[model samples]
Target: MRTCRTRAAGTAVALLLAASALTACGDDGNGAGDGAPPELEIAVGGAADQVTVPDDNPIKEALEEQVGATITSVRTPENLAAMLAAGDAPDFFRLNRTQLDLYASQGLLLDLTPYRDRLQEYIDFVGEDVFELGVIDGKPQAVVRKPAPASYVTYWIRADWLATLGLALPTTVEDFEQVLQAFTTGDPDGNGSADTYGLTGSSTAFNPFAPLWGSFGTAGPGRFYVEDGAVVNGYTDPDTPAAVEYVQRLVGSGVVDPDSFSIDFNEARDRAFQGRAGVMAAGWDAMKKQEFVDAAAAAQPGADWQQLPVMSGPAGDGYITLDPYGASFFAVPASVGEDEAKVDALIDLLNYVSTDEGNRLVSFGVEGTHYTADGDTLAALPALDEDGGYFFVYQLTGRDEETYLEVKFPDEKPFIDVAAAQPLTLVYDSLVVPPEGYTASDAERYATEQLVQFLTGAKSLADYDAFVDELTGQFRYAELIDAGAAQLDELGLTD
Candidate 1:
């Protein structure tokens, strides 16, 4: 219930749908069933690499046959409102949580409440916690997909260095600090040059300093956090100062390169494997990614890296990183509001996409042509490994990471295991933009700026009170919080 806003190519996801279209929705939002046009228009957002679909798209042909819907894909439309105004509306459009809420609030979206029974199976398949995220005003208006794992993000450290220094892995913030000290001072790289630091950080991709904020119990950025029965923003949380101080100390001790504050992710990652730092303070993905591994090998041969154990603080144990809905979600145009048959048909199509057969079809394409399934392993065919990388584009929900990881990263069993054991995802509904004069963005920006100040030693935790006062006094952040809290309470989600 705050304003908003995943990792790897597959796991960390928040299907960011930039397709912005609104129309009168059909009563059912499913569309006419049997007589429905096999052809439909779908707006998909992808990497800049995603251009027009090839003339002979396997997904298009297969989905048409499977769901009796002819689907036309529109690549990267600029504005949803403009599309609607032009009278060229895609029957089913994909939108992120924010757009979904915004359009729904405007009564521009079809209510899927009637089809709850029809969608219950897929909803159950996806799990209640996540599906609940899609509900607006107690009615399901958008489909929320299962998130990919945050496995790409995990504290990775120099195992060789730890072994050389005779140090055990850190299990708590205190131990982590001590390890950083050793990495900073013990010449763990063994070059005897003392050129190495302990950890590294940057402003990109959650940064290596994420554990600092996580330990303070912030639920990612802009989340409506329930603490002591009150909604509080993590930015101004009392403990944020401690988290800030911890990072300041790390930077001050020279364990973290002060330059890290300004560099982007690639530099931080590049610095990690370049032997400039011990305890790389990045994700395990760096260890698994061939290019990164190659770089690490060239810089420091015989170096072994392993993930750091989850570090604990007074509030919780772990790091904070963005998470998202992996599967693209389709929102119905208001134009179909009265067309119950069409809406029902759309629901049927979505239901098929949720099934095991549908998943296999969309994920791997036609079995023999795209990939060969050897029991649980899916070996990609030459074509799919090349041009067909985007086959899963057809999926509207239930993008199972287990299936992908099992097939692609079969050896990294720990990734799926760790994902299963982790707590439920942390996301909030900042979808509905507040009044024209107020923006959650300003407040968030101020908070991020303050955090940066805290880390760079420009500000201290002791100044937190003045910081909070400024945020409330000058920015009027209270309005944002109250609106979110009211919405959360109305939805019975404030707990």
Candidate 2:
């Protein structure tokens, strides 16, 4: 039921491909030579760091010159819905897949399907698998930005405590449990006081022990995986209850920090910094950042925290990897399609960023000033960390993650390498959107409460069947599972 449009006339698809060529493409009355160039209002959002782009920003200037447009970078409006309703939405913006779908459904988004031939360079650069995320209702309504390399959860253990207790690095789940027991009671800190716990982590979705879950061939609850050509939610996976039982045993043994079930990731991290916990599940940046390293050193001068290899279990073992498709997407307003000049400028801008010079310009910033290149390797200058830190907001089309990481955080390379090298458990939740008439938040809350009760022994594992029944009958989880399976199949992701 889907139809495609022919490629628009006069599109400047080859403008940036040649690097030095700045010839105009689509001239719809307001062409560069005819009059003033098209003006594009691009909203910058979703970046954790607040971005302030001055009028003279080199990257912004370069993009405008290449695309033959007056690029105006602005903050994401406080009330985007209101702005869109007022018929004043920004020309381009960043949003999540859900928001993209909503806008596309409302005919507020530009359909890139008509520009498929023009977008060949970008599609080939981003790859078909990841680019598929942009398609909604069988139309390419957004541009899928290929994010940097995925970050993985890692188990950080107190190497000093192991040395003090004369214990070896744990290789298996059983060995890990024994190590936890020793760290709990053996007084590894040498303070001769009952202060330290074996493990600490955030209550994060009520499933802080991700490494443990991974050992059981699953991840935290709410993850989706394909098993034997069937889609299975992690909360109801067969291995999940067994993993929960193991957690209950750990809790009953008092090896896991009780505060872990109550605190957030930051608070859990503070416990590790304060030397109150000997092991923790965290990302490399959380455990090895200079500021955290300094904090740990200040708290316990001789403390040594190191990454522990993934522990093997009866089934298998690995850390849970972030979704490779990425969460944020780039979209253009449907209004832009009304102006051929704007459409051509937008396509030119996107195509340019995916090019070698343009990608490096936006990602690494003005070459020798922000970074230096030696053959294929790029080294960062001090300005890259200082002045160029906020430049990522301009990388609308992501960067080379491995090289970017090496250049940006050279000091953390060892930990980064370790975390990146470990085996990983892949999930497909990002690809599965629940069907209508289902309140996902309500179901998630109900599931979380049930999971917590099971872990805390408030509800016996014998009642797990009852919990699933309630989820199906009360929350309609079965409907969601079926939808997820069908959707994944349609997307060719179940394979």
Candidate 3:
């Protein structure tokens, strides 16, 4: 989004004229006017490169009309922390869940409970769970815009290749392994060379091998929860030994490329696009993107990929790893005027952006100019030489299931339909108990580092045992169990 400092040019001009008049009176004085508009400076940050200001939704004008204030934007991620540290944060900005906790703990954020009524419409639109993500220590600190379910990862494979090789689609972990072996050795790509890999994945924080690990019924990397009234670390669990052994088998059997550990998510996409990798675990949203799916299709015609459900484990158990609970929210810093009127105006702006109309405008852009909407369907505006031009800004507010279904996978309606029909799994229900002195970012970082080491063979299988021991000892699993017991006492799972 665009960031502009909101100072009244008209007021500045008047001040300069007043200064000139004072100079003629032989009074060397500076001139200022009380009638000048109150400029509200707000800092916003996220995935958007350019912020679009609609004629009717001009924030500055809207703020002035509603609350007699002008708004300006300052863009900076670093500034959010720096300003909060000095107790002078921005009027409003985006914050990840972890950062939200840090700021909330320091009492640097405003208690948004008083203004929650103004955001009722927004709260209703995003659902209660998403809305609650902005609450900290029993206080609402921010408003979430775009929130999507976290457990949307799906395994994709070359369907035609599977058919040619006379292999059935893999549903269980054992089946997955058998298929991977065939893809690696049988020249499924028909190149007659055994240079192909069975599976590939990005090493990014989200999708890496955690889901694969989760397939073994262990909470893979970064997942922490109170089980039986105790906090159990997923990575260090006994089940992880089997998971790691599986990874080692994939690596040794040539089903997984040896260099898989070195590749990032995007690079892994390249491997898939180039026909070097035959299988991948990616988000449903990602598979819909033209760059990953369409490009791969064009690179190898008739090589349509199909999404597979999360693999079932030996016990017939399967679960997808959950991402952070909610879409990020925008927090207004205390530096902004604390009056109810100013806060109300800010809420109005947030409310507008979170609505269907506002979200479509921001995401799709200028109706016919960037995209066209036919009833419920939204299509991209004519491309500017193949560049979509910041269309994703609209999606930032919040993504409805229909929008994702339309934009990401128009052809794969059956898969989308199946996923929709499945029961909603409350993966983060237990994790949301809010651990004392714990932050989600810490868990994310720890998982990313430790998991990479394990995947790369940088850490030995025995090291896996040591890692688990160290984690449990440090985090104290028994204490976590006790905490879970106290917090989730009603669930009856801890008793």
- The top-ranked prediction according to TM-score is 2
The 0-to-1 C-alpha lDDT of every candidate, in the order given, reads: 0.66, 0.79, 0.62
RMSD of each: 13.2, 9.3, 9.1
- Which regions of candidate 3 deviate over 4 angstroms? 1-44, 49-74, 85-88, 206-210, 225-232, 236-238, 324-327, 339-341, 355-360, 363-399, 404-463, 474-495
Model 3 global lDDT (CA atoms, 0 to 1): 0.62
Q: Is candidate 1 or candidate 3 better by lDDT?
A: 1
What tens digits encode model 1's per-residue C-alpha lDDT throughout 292-312?
A: 778878977887877764578
Q: At residue 383, give the lDDT of candidate 3.
A: 46
lDDT score, candidate 3, position 384 = 19
TM-score of candidate 3 against the unseen true structure: 0.74
Model 2 TM-score on a 0 to 1 scale: 0.89
- Tens-place lDDT per residue, model 2, 68-121, is 898887788887766776657788787776677678888888889889899877
TM-score of 1: 0.80
lDDT agreement of model 2 with the native: 0.79
